[model samples]
Target: MQTTQIAPSNLGVTHPLDMLTPQEISAARQLLVEAGLVGATTRFPRLLPVEPTRELLAGYVDGDDDYDRSVLVTLLDTATGEAAEAVVSVTRGEVADYRVLPNGEHPYGQPQYLFEEYERAQQIAKADPRWQAAMRRRGITDTTHTYLSPLAPGFFPYEGETGRRMIRSLTFHRNFEGDNAWAHPVEGLICHIDLTAGTVTRVEDDYAETEPVPVPLQTRHYTPEHVGPARTSLKPLEITQPEGPSFKVEGTHVEWENWKLRVGFNAQDGLVLNQVSFRDGDEDRLVLHRASVPEMVVPYGDISNTRFWISYFDAGEYLLGKNANSLKLGCDCLGVIKYFDAFVADDDGRPVKIPNAVCMHEEDYGILWKHTEFGEAPQVRRSRRLVLSYFATIGNYDYGFFWYFYLDGSIQMEAKATGIVYTGATFPGQPNRHAPEIAPGVIAPVHQHIFCARLDVAIDGDANSVQEQNVRGIPMGPDNPHGNAFTWNRTPLTRELEAVRDANPETGRSWFVINPNRKNYVGEPTGYQLIPMPGPRLMAQEGSSAWKRAQFATHHFWATRYDPAERFPAGDYPNQHAGGGIGEWVQANRSLENEDIVLWHSFGPTHIPRTEDWPVMPVDYSGFWFKPHGFLDENPAMDLPDWSSYQGVPGTDVDDAGCCRH
Candidate 1:
């Protein structure tokens, strides 16, 4: 007879078999055995000292001769009660030429062994099919017409015996402010050359003693009368007739969205101070706020430095468009301006009919604009503007000076400026060698060193409404024809791996051998030479099996470049402080079959403050020197001996023996 049974929910019964699956239970037991959790034990030799007497440190500093300081630190290994390796730190002591050597030490010198090995490898690489294929991928081919006509027409011989007259005109504009406020005279001068003589003649400033400046030839000319009426009248758009000292004035705020902005102004002496700021903000922030212009408290000279001018036109909608924004349409207008001065006729010259008038616009917030009439004169007046924009977040502002002149008659804007301070890289030995190795045969030149740099950026107004334009030199090709390039890729990991294997069969292998001591490999493209070993495939496995599998032994160490300054002088310009002063150990050499992996184990960037590191960072250092072992049948005939059998002389003690006692 069958009996029905009901499970009890509150029963306090548990079974060990219910805890794990059969496979999981087996794994647990194996882990315990591997960990020696039951009875795993290690024994040490009696004759050898577990630790050394004292630790030592050593390093070199790069800086001015008097200021650069190398430091070393030592510590006792607490485990074995002996001195381990000494820590080393190097600091720049004085400010001097970083390239000059102080103590007659050539840090960038090439070792003879490295050079010879590199040469031998280069020969082998010459016959490598893979290397040849990479070179072929980098070659360029032309598919378009090779020649094109020049823009300007050439001059022909005149029919008559009349000589061609070359006329050149130069115009100088000067604004003067009284001595009580500003001291120096700022001058803005422009020279135009008319080259009917086959080539454009240089314009010489005989009176001025300064550097020679290049002014391109103009092809087109515009006149004020041709430019049409002013976009906005000189009179105030709206004026508040105040009844008392405190009165509100209505103003219009014009937001310039995604515009290239620049500012500058002519000094009383004609000198122009200009700056440029790129607009990177949302539409809401671009709105120009209408506010009464702040009254100038001091004379023009006293407040000139605070004043600025701004002018911007959409490059795509204005300059590049067939029917673009023009002075006649009044669509092209200066965004802001601080001051305006009327043109006056000189006493020596006839009544100068100054038809051209300048316009000034000030949007609320911190923006100003100035617009000048563009047309033909006796000569073209070189108009230059300066713009200044500050980034609030990055705490840095760009000062841009724009020079606009008629080139072949069309207006061209030229930008000339420099960036501010930031952090840089620090490379211990050679700077160039620090750059990444992209190609097989290309070695980063030896003279290069690493540096740290910081970037300070600021965008005004709505951060979202900014526009990006005018980018150059990006690589977009197979094999990346450009040596150093990056690409945006959208692919699944499995697909990417599949594509890699499809493209390069050799790259699909479980392990690849590299000789860091040699610069390149010279040989035909062939399969990797596998080193025979007795072990489960560690390099090919995915888990603890790989950890248990061993092909050869390896070691590592750590070193540091001591930097004294807490902060860079110019903040962080280009994200220069990312890694600080630490560098990782690059692989030295590797061989599979002969158990020939010579690894330099090293430490990474970690902040562990010791007693000597207090007040300031003291020297910290670590290194690894390989003790090669023999694995060949000819034992003694092998280049390396059995380092495991090495023993110290009587009474001599060695520290760090635990690191190598296997």
Candidate 2:
């Protein structure tokens, strides 16, 4: 049932999980077992998708789960018995076929690996004397040696076949105030485990004169001498949808006014939107085929073996969505909200529910349109947007992502980075000044959260082209003219390298993905403009670990020809990738003129911690957007209703206004 109104009821909450459920997960495992695909010498079976396909869900209906018509499964056969990822198909509870895939095949989604680290940590803590002592120093006994997910040890050719060897740099949790794990850090310890042999290969217990510092969450901790006790006296706020919600929900499909989008989840990419389009007067026009953060590289400034060698590809190395914290009303979001649940599997191939993994709602966005003449009352209308958002708790940091669809045919994308940072221990009262110390004897390393989103742009039709718009001032030449005049030098970016450019500080350059076939009333082509908010690009030097692998991040904008095989800028297996992703793709310099194209936009923050950011950091934000460029005849937001009628001033009655009393 579609419950548009805001009511706290299971009927309103539960929806069929869009991804593969536990039954299907079990089925995949069993199919491999029946085919004798499992043996002692083989690697653990991992079920995954064969191809990157964005199929629109069969129209959502009441009492029905959003069932996918067919399933294409890929199994990573890492066992010595078989090393290639095998492809299998299943339709309506029946196994179809099996085929050995080709090289560069990283189809199986890696979600269950992170969970395996917890058990591995407990086992190492009990077996290794150093790990035991490190835990002991923090009062962590055998009963509670819970471990934080370690940094993914990136693969190098020297470390051949790292798929069998899982290296996790461990941290201890100081869960306080009912917060999830990652409140504290048992710094300066890293554990490398051989997953194939199921043994701890090595443990890093010491670093250059630094000890394992343990910092606890103490947001409410205070001195009794001059402080009030912990209190909660705030009034309750509720958003009751008396007339149901304006947005009609039919499973994963959400329809409100002119906007229509299909939402889904990936173990790595988290909230994904497909077939995003808006009604342009009579017909629907395509904006983007698929949109999600495919690669997120968080590189810490500290370069120690335990910290320096770590560069996190959160979306790939760690499934960011798998780390999502279940959201709650009044805390995560408010207003008439509709929730969507995400489904993924645990290490045992059992399905787990990430409830309320994505939230959708309409919010008042202040003024949509407002205008007034001199000494005249203004006419104004409130603006509103349909917001779809989700968050991921990636160990020490929590990142909130949002996609906002405004009434005026503009889309704004934003990411908010919060939560505590991973730390290293120091001598009490002798913290290093270069690295910001979160607590006594703790160093919170400075880092950059660089995220790249893959955008498949289809404006009006597939034959769309991209143009770079640079505003240049006119040179004062003949005719004795001054150099005050400027014109937009719009040039067609016809190839991959031509599209690789930076946001000009002089002109604030923007790229417009336009359709030459479609024109507005004034004969100008219809298009959407991509404008990036100010944020520092990747600052790592050339040949540096951070720079070499994530070279896609050096530029804030990119345009590539649409190829099904090319989805992520940082490649599929980025764990120890030696720069073979976007850099290789663009270096080919493929033709980009008048063909299907994908827009890759990257935006993020470089965090240098301060005293105010300790305990928990206030949310830091960065974003970009798609604005209409010669696409419409007039401002679409001009349709907003006149609000002078509801102007609550005391001058409604003209006769009495002449002598009105206070």
| Winning candidate number (lDDT) | 2
lDDT, candidates in the order shown: 0.18, 0.67
Stretch of 10 with least lDDT, candidate 1? 291-300
Q: Give the TM-score of candidate 2.
A: 0.82
Tens-digit per-residue lDDT, 1-662, candidate 1: 22212111111101110111222222322333343321222110000001101111012122212211211111111122121121111121111111211111211110001112222333333333433332233231221211111111111122321122211221211122211101011111212112222222332233245432221111111234534676774653332112211111111111222222222111110112111122212321111111000000000011111111000011100110111111222311233222212121111111112111122222222212223457732222222222221100000111111222111111111221122111011122322322221112111111100011111111121111111112133466776676666433222111111211111122221222222222222431111111111111112122221111110111111111112221121111101011111111112211122122211111111222222221122222211111111111121112222323656332321112111111
Give per-residue CA lDDT, model 2, range 510-626, as digits (tens): 989999998988998899999987577887777886787887789988898888778668775565455567878988888787888999988899888776775567899988899
Which portions of model 1 miss their true places by more than 4 Å?
Answer: 1-154, 159-162, 166-339, 342-356, 362-662
Q: Total clashing residue pairs per candidate?
A: 89, 6
Candidate number achieving the greatest TM-score relative to the actual structure: 2
